[model samples]
Target: MVIRYSFDSLQPRPIDLPTEVPLDDEADLSVLDEAKILAAPASRADVERWRDQIERWREEARSRLCYSGAQYDRIESQWAQTCFAVAQVWLWDELLYSFEDHVFTPQKFLADARQRLGGLDAVVLWHAYPVIGLDDRNQWDYYRQIPGLKELIAQFHAAGVRVGVDYNPWDTQTRRGKADVEELAALVADLGADAVFLDTLKTAEPELVEALERAKPGIVLEGESRVLLARIEDHGASWAQFFADSPVPGVLKSHFFERRHMLHHVRRWHRDHSEEIQSAWVNGVGLMMWEVVFGVWVGWNKRDRSTAARMLTLQRSLSHFLLEGQFTPLVECADNADDKLVFGSSWKRGTDTLYALVNRSEIPITLKPIREETGIVQLDLMTGAVAQHLAITIPARGIAAVMTSQGEINPDMIELASEVSAIELSDDARFEHRRVHRVHESSRSKNTGESGVLIEPGEYVLTVRYRGRETGMYDGAPYVDEWKPLVPRLHDPRTLERVTTLDNPVIVAQHEVTNDEFLHFVRESGYQPAVSNRFLLHVKDGVNGRGHEPVCFVSLEDARAYCEWVGGRLPTEDEWQIAGDKQGFQRLEPHVWNWTESEYSDGRSRFAILKGGSDAQYDESEWYFDAGVRPPDFSAKLLLMGLGMSRSERIGFRVAFDRRNK
Candidate 1:
C-alpha cells in the first residue's frame, strides 16, 4: 500500500518545527470504589527484614515462536518479538506521605492519595510492603486493618490502577502472622494487589510467578534488578532504578530499546528542571514516577508539559514496534557525550525501518538525511504528526522518531539461471528444533528450480536460478528484461538487517573563509560589531575566519561577508539542492550540508535553509522500503531540500558565481 502524507497548511511555515500535541492529564477510567476490593487476609508471613525466593525453568507459553510455510514447506520466521511494557508506576510510602509535621493530618494524606491515584494515569500504584508505623513506634501488622486503608486500595482498583505491594518473601520471621507463600498469595489476592516488587531479586523463577498467579491471576512480579532470564514464567517486566531521570544527567541512557519490558522509574523527576524527564523519553525510556508520593510532585510548566506530553504521545504510538521487533542497533552515535552532541537507534519490520533519534546534549545537533530512503519525516510522538522534513533538528535534550518509507524487493519477482551449484537445497529438513508452516503459494520451475518458501534450520537460504538480462527486438522497439535478486534478508526471520550505520548529519565550510578574507571584508566595510557574528568567540578555532579549513562558528552575517569579499553569493535553496544532487556533475554527495539563501519563512529573520543533511544519527522508517517502486514525482533535487540557521559546527558560504563571472 502506498502511504501518502497530507501536509497541514496551519503549521509554522518554512519550518523551524517542534510542536507538542496536548494530552489529557486525568484518565477517564475510574478506580474500583467498592469495599470488596480491600479484602483483609487472615495471616501473611512475608516481612520487610528477610525476603524469600524461588527458581524455575523457562516458560515456553509466554513466547509465541513465529512460523511460516505449508505442510510440506514450513518455515520458522525470526521471533525478534519484544513486549515493551513501559508502565508508569506510582511508588508511594504511606507513612511518610500521610503525616505533615509531627502531627498526623489524615486530610492532607487523603488529598495526596487522591492526587496520586486519581490525577495520575498510572497503570500500577506501588504501596511499600511493610506498614512500619509512625515512630518505629507504630508497627502496623497489616495494611488492610489500618483506618481508611480499604478505601485507598478500592479507589486504586476502580481507577484500573493495579496495586502492587512490596513483597519480601525472604524475611518471614519478623511478621507475627502467617507469611509463607500461601499467606503472601492470599494477601495479594485479597488486597487487589496486581504486582509485587520482589526486593533483592535473584531470578524470575516460575515458582514465584506461578504462586503469585495462584492468588492473583494477572498479577505482575517485578524484581529489584533487571532480569535477563527471559526464563521466568511471568517475569516479563521489571523496574530498573529508583530515578528514571538519572541524577547525574546525560549519564543514564535508558535501554528501553534492548530491555523493552523494564520501567526505569524516575524517582527524582521534579518540576523545576524537567529537561531530565524530556531527555529520558528521547533516550527511549518511558515517563515514570510523576506522582504525589515521596516528593512534592510539582507539576510541569508549559515547556516541560510540551515535551512530557510529546514523550507520552510517542509511547502510545511506537509501543508495539519497541515491544515486538528485535533490537538491531541503528548505528546511533556512541553513548559517549561531551556536553554537545548525541544520537539514537533503529529497528525494522520486513523491508520497512523505524529509527529513534534523540539529542541528549544542551546544544542543538543537526544531521544529514540518510541515503536510499524516502518519505523522511520528523515524527511528532504526541499526535503522530509528520512535521516538515527540511526542518529536522532534534531540540537540545529532545527526541524525534523518524522512519523510511521504501518499497520492498521480493525474491520471487526475479528470474534466475539454471546450473544448480553449491547453493543447493537439502530435500531433508535438517535440525528439527523448530517448526514452519508456509501459508502462501508454491511455484515450480523445470530448469532453474521450484519457487516457494523453504523451511529449514540455521538460516534458511532461497536457492533460485539467476540469468543475465537479454535484449530483444519487439515490433516497435528493443525490449530488455532487468534481473533482480531475492533481497538477502536475515538467516531466520525474513527481517532485513542494517549493517551500515545511518550516516551522521553532514558538516561543510569550504575551508572556513581564511583570516585574510575576513580582514579584507572588515577593511572595506568596517566590520560592524552589531552585524558581525556575536557568538564569534565560539569559533575559537579561528579569530578572524583565517586558516586553510572552513571557519568554525561563523554567524550567518560573517559567512555572507566573507562570500561577498570573494565575489560570490550564498546559493539559493534550489541551487543548493541542485549542487547537493550533483546537478549535471553528480559526484558522490558530500557529507557537508552547505548553506542556502532561503528564509525559514519569507521573513527578515536569519532562519536560512541548510542543505546536504547533517551527518548525525537519524531514525529510519519501517515503511522506507515498500514493494512496487515508482518513478520520482519530480526529480531528486526536490528530495534534498532542508532548513537550519544557527549553531552549526562550521559556517562557510557556497558561492554561486554569476553566469558572467563564471
Candidate 2:
C-alpha cells in the first residue's frame, strides 16, 4: 500500500532549483555554506565550467584556510568514508535495552540491524537530552552510571560494528563538570568509541579536537549538520540532515572537496525517505538509519529498506569505486536524454567505470542503453548478469547500477551480486505505525485505612498542559513529516483537553509519599526488587533524615510495590487531575513530580505521565526535561529507562484507591 501523503507541502520537489555560487577567484565561498544543493548548468558544455569553478574554489580555500588531511589519512579514521549506514539509536530503544528483563541486549539489537538495515557500520548510542536535566546529574552521569556499557560496545565491535557516543553541547545548565573538551575526550577513550556525534554543533572547537585526539588517536568527529569548509579537514563526517536535492542531481560540497569525507543524509521526522536515499545514491554518501527519533518512531517503509539493502550491497562491495574513483554528478544517459525523471552518475577508477541511477517517479523506467561507448563488457552489478545492450529497468523510486570493467571483477563484488539477487525488493511504502498502550498491572484490592481526597465517578473534561516536545503528549509523532521542527511547534507550551470517564470513585492522597513513609513500607514488607541498581539512592546510612520530604529515586515498580503494601495503588492521570481540582489536594513542600498509573508503551519506548512538576529546573536550554513547579493539570511524559536510570530525585509518587475496594 502506498501511504499517500495528504500534505502537498510535505511532497518532495523533484525539480527544486539549486543555488549557484559565483565562480570569481575572489568570490566569497561563505555563500555556499548553508546551500542544500548546488545548481548544475543545463548545457553539457557549461557543466565542465561548473566543475572547474568548484575545483578551483576548493584548491584556493585549502590554501587560504591552511587545511590539513592528517586525520583522514589514518587507517582508523578511514572507516567513516565507507560507513554507509549508521543508526542514531536511543540507548533504551526496545531492541537494544529490554524493559521487562532489565538488561542491555546487544545481540538482539545487532540481529535486527542485520535483518532490516542490512547491518550497520556504526551506531550513535544517543543518551540523555529529552530525559536529561531532570535533576543535578549531568550528561556524564547518564553514561557513567549505566552498567556494562563498555561490554556492550565490545559486543558491537565483535559483530564488526563500531559505536559512536553522542555529545550535546547544549548540556550546560546541569551539574558542573570538567570542561566540555576534557569530559568528551575522557568519555570517548573510556568507552573505546570509534566516533563522537556532536549534537547541535557543526564542528568541535580546535581545543576540543586536539584534546580528543590526545585521549584517543584517530577518533572521528561527526557534526550535526554541514561541517565547516576549513574544519572538514579534521572532522571525518557530517550528518547531511534536511539536505534538499536538485531536480538534476548535484554535488555535495564537502564530499566533492574531499572524497574521503562521509555524509549521512537524514531527515529525523520525515516518514518517506525516497528523496534522501536517491540523493545519497548519486553522491556515493551514507544514510542515517534512525527509526526511533528520541522516543518517537519515524520508521522507514519496506520500499525504502529494500532500496537501502541494494545500496549497501553495492557500497560495501565497491568502496574502491566510491572512495578512490573520480566521481561525476549528473552523468548523461547515452540514449534516454529526455528521461528527466531518471538521473545517473558515473564513477571511474583504474580500468573500471560504474554508473549509478535512480528513478524519482512512481512508474518504472527502462534505460535503452548506457556506457555503450565504453566498448567494454557492461555488467548489471545488482544482478550479476552480463548486459549486451546495457539496458535495465529501474523500479519506481528505486535504484539500479551498471559497471564496465576491463579487468577481473573483485570477489567482494561477486558476493554482493549473489546476495542482492536473493533479496525480494519490497514495494510496500506504508508507514509501520506503532500505537502507545497504557500498561496495567494488577494490584491488591484490599482496604487501606487512610484518609484522602475523594473524586466522584463521572465524565470530566480535564485541561491538561504540557511542554510540546519531540515525544508527543499521548500518541503519534509531534512533528509529522516536517523538515525541521522549530519554535512554536517545538518546546512550545501545548494544551490538551482529555475527556475521561471514571466508572468508580477514587481516593487520592492529598500529599506525596514521604521518605519516612516509604522506609516503613520497606522495613515492614521486607521487599526486594529484581534489579537492585539505583534503588533507594537518596537513603544513606540505612536512614533518610528528611522523613517529611517526598520519597524520591524510586523506580515505578518500587513505588508500585510500596503502594501495594498499603492496599492502595498509584492514581491514574485522570484521577490525579480530578483530585487536584478539589480544594483539599495539597502539594508537599520541595515539590517533585508524582508518578501515576499511566505507564505506556509503543513497543519501542515506555513512558509514564508525570504530574506536579519538581522544583529543580535546568535553565538556558530547552532540551532539558520539563522542570519548575507546575500546576496539577500539567503533565510531562517521561521516557522510562531500564536499570534504575528512570529513577530520579525529582520524581515521586502518591497513593490512590477505588472507593468500593476501600
Say which candidate scores most in lDDT. 2
Candidate 2: regions farther than 4 A off: 1-18, 22-30, 33-36, 43-45, 407-412
TM-score of each: 0.39, 0.94
Report per-prediction Cα RMSD to one decimal. Answer: 32.4, 4.0
For model 1, the superposed segments whose C-alpha errors exceed 4 Å read 1-140, 147-151, 169-175, 200-207, 228-233, 242-260, 267-285, 290-306, 332-340, 350-352, 368-389, 406-662
lDDT of 1 by residue, 1-662 (tens): 85443332222122112111112234221111101011111112211111111000001212232211121111110110121222333222222222112122334433443332222333343332211210011112334433344566676556544455665444432334543565667777776665676655734456656777778655656665344333322443445433222222221211421243344433232333244454444334444443322112223334443445444444445555555544433233322322234444555655545566666565566654333336433332322334334234565655555544444322211111111111221222121111112112112111211221111112222221111111000011011111111112101112122122211112122222443555456668766543232334434443543344443445455556555655555544444433343323221221233445543311101124344432322112111111111111111111111111132342334444432111
Task: Give the TM-score comparing model 1 with the true structure, all chains together.
Answer: 0.39
Alpha-carbon lDDT of model 2:
0.83
Model 1 scores worst on lDDT over the 10 consecutive residues at 49-58
Model 2 C-alpha lDDT per residue in residues 73-154, reported as the tens digit of each score: 8997888889999999989988999888888988898888878878899999988978997898889989999888899999
